[model samples]
Target: MAGRNMNVYFQEETYSKIKNLVAKREISRFINEAVEEKLKQRQQQQKEELRKKLIVGYQSRIKNKKLQKILLTYGEMSWEDLSAKLEEQEKNDDNCKK
Candidate 1:
């Protein structure tokens, strides 16, 4: 793929290892591939962490008595109607807080 040139610094030992392990001219490609892989791994790790947090949040909400009461009161409504009711309630709440 086409790319731009930039400078990157590596510690002495790490630099020496890469230089010795890769073909002299392929150092840039080796580093680019390594960086891309590391970025992908980190992004995947972050997504998994967020998913776990969301599950925890949802579990906590399920255990809330207030939320349970609200759900029970609105549960009989159609999903679309219930959403509208909840949004209206939220707006009323924000107005009250002000």
Candidate 2:
């Protein structure tokens, strides 16, 4: 495959190990594969983190929609009925907060 040639450096100890273990002509290939593997790992981690954030955001929206429904129910109640309903809703809010 066609590739760019650029200067690269490694610590003396690491370079020694790489030269000892890898064929001299293949050191560039070894470093390239290592970089590719690390890139894949980071990309996968970012995708997973974004997925988790999306799920949390969706759950929050659903909770807000339910609260809106509850508010509508209260809006139709008589003042005398509202106190009991408000107290019930407060208890539910406390439970959900935990």
lDDT of each: 0.92, 0.93
Query: lDDT by residue for model 2 over 5-94, one digit each (tens)?
Result: 898888999999999999999999999999899999999999999999999999998879978898888788889899887789999999
lDDT of 1 by residue, 1-98 (tens): 89999988899999999988999999988999999999999999999999999999988987897978977887778989988987999999999999
How displaced is residue 2 in candidate 1, in Å?
A: 1.6
Quote the positional error of residue 3 for candidate 1 in Å: 0.9
Error of 1 at 8 (Å): 0.6
Which candidate has the top score in lDDT?
Answer: 2
Worst 10 residues of 2 by lDDT: 66-75
Q: Write down the lDDT that model 2 would get.
A: 0.93
Residue-pair clashes per prediction, in order, are 0, 0
Error of 1 at 53 (Å): 0.9
Model 2, backbone clash pairs (residues 3+ apart or across chains), number: 0
Error of 1 at 21 (Å): 0.5
